[model samples]
Target: MENLLYLFILLALGKISRRLSAFPENTPQILNLFVIYFSFPATVLLKTKNLNLGTDLAVLALTPWALMLMTVLGIRLIAWYRRWDRKTEGTVMLCTGLGNTSFLGFPAVAAFFGEDALSYAVIYDQLGTFLGLAIFGTLVVSVYGTSTRPSIKQIILNIIGFPPFLALTASLCLMKVTFPLPVIKLLEGVSATMIPLVMFSIGAQLRLRQPFSNVKPISLILFLKMMVFPLMVFFCLTMMKVHGPVLHISVFESAMPSMVMSGVLAQSGRLNAEVANAAIGYGLVLSFITLPFFDLLLKMFP
Candidate 1:
C-alpha cells in the first residue's frame, strides 16, 4: 500500500512538473519516440533473446489480446447502433480498445506481483499489446479518420518502423546469439528506464480541459473499459481453466486504464479530441478504484 501511494505521488509530481516547467509540450513525444525507438527495443532484444518460448506461455499471453479485440468489436457495434460518426467511433475504439498495458500495467504488476511477474507482463505487453497497437490501432485510426484505406505497404512500414516491434522481432530472431556480460548489464540498465519514462510522459500529456464537455460518451466508454473489458478477460480465463499468475496478470492487464496515446492519436488524426481526452483522464483517475477490486476478485477466483 505504501509503495502504491509512492507510485501515485511520483506520477503526481511528473504531472506538476510538466505544467510548471518550461519544457516544450512536444518533449513527451520526443522522449516517447526515443524510448520506443531505442531503449524499448534494447530491452526487448535483451530480455526476449533467451526466453524459453512455449505454447502454454504463448496462450496465456494472448488471453488479453483476444479479450481486447472482442471488446473493440462490441464497442464498435454499440457506436454503430448509436449512429456515431467516424471520428467519434475512432476515438471510442482507440480509447476502450487500447489499455495502458505497457506504461501503467507493467509497473503495477511489478509492485504487486514482484519482479518474477515482469516476464509475463512483458510478454503480454510486447506480443499482445504492442502488436495490437501496430496493427489494429493503426487500422482504426486510418480507416475512421480518412476516406481511403491505408496502402498495404503503409501498414507494413508502420509495423516494421515501430521501434519496440522491431526490437521484439530482432530479439526473437537473435535468440540463439549470446552477448558479453557487460553488454547485457548495459542493456538491462537502459531497459529499466522505459517504464518510468513512459509513465511520466503519460502524466505530462494529460489535459483536463479537452475532456470537459463529453461526460455522457466518456461515461459509456469508461464502463466498457473498466467493467466490460475485465469481465471478458475473466470469462476467457475461467473457460480456459487458467490459474495462478498467468490468470492474475491477464486480469490486471485487462483492467488497465485507457491508453494515454489515444489522446495523442486523436490530436494527430484530427479526430474527436473531447472523447479521447475524457477516456484518458477518466480512465487514469478511475483505475485506482477498479484495480484493487480486480485484484481482490482474482484472489477470489479458484
Candidate 2:
C-alpha cells in the first residue's frame, strides 16, 4: 500500500516538474543516464547475485524475448492489414512490444509480491526485456525508425558496450564468490536510488493528450501491451505447467505498460511521436487498474 503511494507520488512529482521552470527540460534524460550507467547495474548485481538460480529461471529469462518476437509479428500483420504507414507501424511496434518491466516493474512487483520476488523481476528485466531494448528495440527503431539508420556493426558495438549488460556479465562471474561486506553495502546504496529516479523520469516523460485522431492506434497498442500479451503468456506458461513465482512474476512483468524508453526511442528515431508517447503515458495510467486485475487473475493458477 505504502509502496504504491510512493510510486504515484514520485510519478506526480515528475509530471509536475514538467510545468516548473526550476526543473530543466532535460531532467528526465539526465536522470535516465544515471539509471542506465549506475543504478541499473548496481541493482542487477545486488538482486541477482544471490538469486537461487532456481526452477524456471530459464523460462523467466526467455519469456520477454518470446513476448517481443510475438509482438513484432502480431503488429506487423495488423499494420499490413490496416495499411498503416511505416512510421505508425514502427511506433506501435516499439511502444507496444517493450514492457515497462524495470522502471515501473520493480516497485510494483514489490508492492504486490514482496521484495524477495524482485530477483525474478531482475532476471526478467535484464536478461529479457533490457537486452531486448538494446538488441531488438534498436533493430525495430533502425529498420522502422528514421532513414538515418545505424549500421549492423554499430549496433553490435552498442549491445556489447551497454552498461547494464556489462553488469549482468560481471554479476554472473562473481555469483559464486562472496563480495566483501563493504562492497555489497556500497552496491546496495547506489542501487536503492533506482525506483524513485526511475518513477520520476517516467513521470517527467508522460503526456496524457495526443490528438484525438490518435485514439484507435493508441487503443490497439494498449490492448496488446497491457492486456492481451500478458494473458497470452500466462495461459501458455500455465499449459506448460509453469507455476510458483516464475509463473507469477513472468506474467506480472509482461503486463507492465509500454517501456518508458520505447517512447524516448520513438521520438529519437523520428517515428510517430504522437502515438508512441500517448501509448506510453496512457498505458502507465491504465496499469494501475490492469495490474491488480492481473494479480487477481493470477491467483487462480497459483
Candidate 3:
C-alpha cells in the first residue's frame, strides 16, 4: 500500500514539475536513456545474478511473446475488417500490444508483490516485453512506418546493440560468479533510481488536454491492454497449471498501461502519433483502477 502511494507521489511530483516548467522538455529523454542504459541494466544484473532458472520462469519469460502474437493477429484482422489505414493500425498495435513493463511495472510489482518477487517482474520486463520491443516492435514500426523498410540484418543488429540486451547477456555470464559486496551495493544504489525516475518520467510526459476527443480508439486500446490482454494471460497460464506467484506476477505486469516508448516509436515511424500518445496518456491514468481490480481477480484464482 505504501509502495503504491510512493508511486503516486512521485508521479504527482513529475506532473507538478511539468506544470511549473521546472525542467527542460528534453530532460525526460535523458532520464529515460539513463534508466535504459544504466539503471535498468544495473537492476537486472543485481537481481538476476544468483537467480535460479526453471521451466516456470521460462514460461513467465515467454508471456509477452504470447501476448504479442495475439495482439498482432487481432490488430491485423481488425484493421482489415475496419479498413483502417496502415499507420492507424500500426499505432494501435504498438501502443496496445506492448506495455510499460519496465517503468511502471517495476514499482507496481514491488508494491503489490513485494521486493522478493521483483525478479519475476524483471523476467517479464526484460525477457518478455523488452525482447518484444527490440525485435517484434521494430518489425511493426518498419512495416507500418513511412521510413524505408529496414533489412533483417538491421533488425538483428539493432537488438544486439540495445544496452539492456547486452546487460542480459552479461548478467547470464555473471550468474555463476559472485560479485564483490561493494560492487553489488553500487549496483543496488544505481538500480534504486529506476522506480522513481520511471514514474516521474511518465508524469512529466503526460498531456491530458483533449484526451476525450479520441475516445473510441482509446477505449478499445484500454480494454485490450488493461482487461482483455491480462485476462487472456491468466486463463492461458492457468490452463497450463501454473499458479501462485508466477501466475499472479505475470498477469499483473500484463495489466500495465501502454508502453510510453511506443508513442515515441509511433512518431518516429510516421505512424498515427496522435492516437499513440492519446492511448498512452489515458491508459496511464486508467491503469490505477484496472490494475487493482485485476490484482483482486487474480487472488481469486487459487
Candidate 4:
C-alpha cells in the first residue's frame, strides 16, 4: 500500500508543479533526458548482472516479447484499417506495445505478491521490457518519426547509439565479473531514484483534460493493454497449466499501463506528444482500478 502511495503522491506532486511558478516549461523534458541517459542505464546494469539463464528464466523473460509482438501487430493492423495518420500510429505503437514493468510493475507486484516476487519482475523487465524500450521503441520512433522513412543505416546507428541499449550490451558482457561492493551500492542508490522521477515527469507532462480527438485511439490502447491482451495471457497460460508465480506475474505484467518512457520516446521522436501523454496519464489512472480487479480474478484460479 505504501508503495502504491508513493506512485500516486509523486504523480500528484508533479501535476501540482505546473501551478507553481518555479518550474520551467521544459522541466519534464529535462527529466526525460536524465532518465534516458542516467537512471535507465543504472537500473538495467544493476538488475542484469549475475542473471541466471535457466529454461524457466527464459520463459519468464520471453513472455513480455510475446505480448509486444501481439501489440505491435494489432496496432499496425488497426492503424492501417483506420487510415490513422503516422503520428497517431506511432503514438499507439510505442505506448501500447510496451508495459510499465519496471517503475510501476516493481512496486505493484511487490505490494500484491510480496518482495520475493521482485526477482521474477527483474527478469521480465530487464530482459524483456527494457530491451523492448531500446529496440522496438527506437525502431518505431525512427520509422514514424517523420514523413520520410529513415535509411537502414540511420536506424541501425540510432539503436547502436541509444544509451540504454549500450548499457544492456555492456551488462551482458560483464555478467561474470563481480563489481566491487561500493560500485553496486552506488548503482542501487541511483536506480532507486528512477520511479519517483519518472512518475513526476509523467504527472507534469500529462494533461488531465485530454482532447476528444485522442479518445478513439486511447480507448483502443487501454482496451488492449489493460484488458483484452492480459485476459488472453491469463487464459492461455492457465490452459497451459502454468500456475504459481509465473502465471500470476506474467499475467499481471501483461496488464500494466503503457511504458512511461514510451511517452518520452514519442515526444523525442517528434510523434504525437499529446496522444502519448494522454494515453500514459489515462492509463495510470485506469490501472489502479483494473489491476486489483484482475488480482481478484487471479486469486480465483489460485
Candidate 5:
C-alpha cells in the first residue's frame, strides 16, 4: 500500500515538473527514444539471459498477445458499426488493446509477486507487447492514420532497429558468453532508468484540456481496457489451468493501463487528438482503482 502511494507520488511529481517546464519539451521524447532503442534491449539481454524457458513461460507470454489482438479487432468492428471516423476508430483500437505492461505493470507486479516473477513478466512484456507494437501496432497506426501506407521498409527498420529485439537476439545467440561484473553493473544501472523515464515521459505528454463531448466513448474504452481485458485474460488462464507465479503475472500484465505509445502513434498518424487524449487520461485515472482490484484477484486466485 505504501509502495503504491510512492508510485502515484512519482507520477504526480512528473506531471508537476512538466507543468512547471522543468524539462524541455523534447527532452522526454529523446529519453524515450534512448530507452526504446538502447536501455530496454540491454535490460532484456541482461535480465533474460538465463531465463528457463518452459511450457508455462510460453503460455504466460502468448496470453496477452492473443487477448490484445482480439480486443483491437473487436474495437475496430464496433467503431465500424457506429461509423466512427478514422481518427476515433484508430484511437479506440490502440487505447483499448495496447497496455503499459512494462512501465507501470512491472513495478506493480514486483510489489505483489516479487523479483522472481519479473523475468516472466519481462518475457510477456517484451516478446508480447514490444513485438505487438512493432508489427500489429504499426499496422493499425498506418492503416487508420495517414493517407499513405507505412512502407514495409519502415516497419522492417523499426522491428530490426529496436534495441530490445536486438538484445533478445544477442542473448539467445551468446548465452554462453560471460560479461565482466563491472560491465553487468553498468548495464543494470542504465536499465534501471527505463521505467521512471518512461513514466515521466508519459506524464509530460498528457493533455488534460481535451473536451468531454466524447466522455461516453472514452469511458467505454477505459472500461474495456482496465476491466474487461483483464477479465478475459483471467478466464483464458483458468481454461488453460495455469497456476502460481505464471498465473499471477498474467493477470498483472493484463490489468495494466493503456500504453503511452498509443498517443504518440495517434499524433504521428494525425488521428483525433481529443479522442487520443481522452483515452490516455481516463485510462491512467481509472488504473488507480482497477490495479488494486487485480491485486486482490491475484491473492484470491487458487
Candidate 6:
C-alpha cells in the first residue's frame, strides 16, 4: 500500500505543479519522451531478460491482447449505438481499449499479490499492452484520426520502431545470456523511475474541469474500463479453464484505467483530445475504489 500511496503522491505533486506552473509547458512532453525511450524499455529489459518462455507464459501474455481485442469490438458496438462522431468514437475506442497496465499494473500487482507475480504483469504489459499501443493503437489513430490513413508498411514500421518493442525482442533473444550484476543493478535503478515518472505525466495531463459535453462519454469509458472490460476478461479466461495467479493478474490489469498516453495519441491523431483526457482522468480516480472491489471479487473465484 505504501507504493500505491507514493504513486498517488507523485500524481498529486504533478497536479500541484501544473496548477502552480512549477515547470515549463513542455516539461510533461519531455518526461513522456524519457519514459517512452528510456525508462519503459529499461523496465521491460529488467523484467524480461531472464524470463523463461513456456506454455503458461505464452497464455499469460495473451491476456492483454485478448482483452483489448474484446474492447475494440465492444467500443465499435457502443459507438454505433450512440452515433458518435468519428473523433469521439476513435478517442473512446483508444481510452477504453488501452489500459494503464504499465504505470498502474506493475506496482499494484506487486503490492496485492507479491513480487512473484510481477513476471506475469510484465508479460501482460510488454507483450500485450505495449504492442497494442505501439501497433494497433496507431492503426486506430490512422483510421479514425483526421490524419491521412497510414499504409500497412507504416504500421509495421511504427511497431518495429518502438523502443519498448525493440527491448522486448532483445530481451527474448538474450534470455539465455546472463547480464553482469552491475549491469543488472543499473537497469534496475533506471526501471525504478518508471512508475513515478508515468504517474506524474498522467497527473500533469489531467484536466479536472472537463466540459459538460464530455460527461457522457467519460462515464461510458469508466464503465467499460473499470467494470465491463475486466468482467469480460474474467469470464472468458475462467471459461477457458485458466486459474491461479496468472488469471488473477490478468483480470486485475484489465480493470485498470485507460493508458495515460491515450490523450497524447488523441491529440497527435487529431481526434477528440478533450474526451480522451477526461476519460483517463476520471477513470483513474475511479479505479482507486474499483480495483479493491475487483480484488475482493477475485478472491471469490473458486
- Candidate maximizing lDDT: 4
Q: Return the lDDT, model 6, position 227.
A: 93
Against the unseen true structure, what C-alpha lDDT does each candidate score?
Answer: 0.72, 0.81, 0.78, 0.84, 0.72, 0.78
Q: Model 3, range 1-302, lDDT digits (tens) per residue? A: 45556766876787788767669877666777777778867876875566555775897788889889989999899888977788888888898889988777888888777898788888888778876775676678767875455678776666676665577678878778979999989999999987777667756765566456456666778889999999998988899999988999999999998987676566656787668766776777787799889878987975
TM-score of each: 0.76, 0.76, 0.74, 0.92, 0.75, 0.80
Candidate 4 Cα deviation (angstroms), residue 212: 1.7
Error of 6 at 2 (Å): 2.2
Best by TM-score: 4
Candidate 2 residues 95-122, lDDT tens each? 8878888768988999889999998998
- Predictions ranked by TM-score, top down? 4, 6, 2, 1, 5, 3
Task: Give Cα distance to truth, residue 158, candidate 2, Å.
Answer: 2.6
What is the Cα-based TM-score of model 5? 0.75
What global local distance difference test value does model 1 have? Answer: 0.72
Looking at model 2, report the run of 10 residues with the lowest lDDT sum. Answer: 47-56
- The digit string of per-residue lDDT tens for model 6 on 1-302 reads 56556767877887887867559887767776777788867877876666455676776678777777876788889889988888888898888888888767888888778899888888888777876876667767767775555677776666677676688778878888989999988888887877677667667766778878788888888898889878988988899898888789889988988887676677656788778867876776787899998889888884
Q: What is the Cα-based lDDT of residue 286 in candidate 6?
A: 84
TM-score of 1: 0.76
The runs of at least 3 residues in candidate 1 whose Cα sits more than 4 Å from the true structure, single-residue gaps closed, are: 1-7, 17-21, 82-88, 101-123, 130-148, 209-213, 240-246, 259-278
Indicate the worst ten consecutive residues by lDDT in candidate 1. 1-10
RMSD in angstroms between candidate 3 and the native structure over all alpha carbons = 4.1
Of candidate 5, the 10-residue stretch with the lowest lDDT total is 1-10
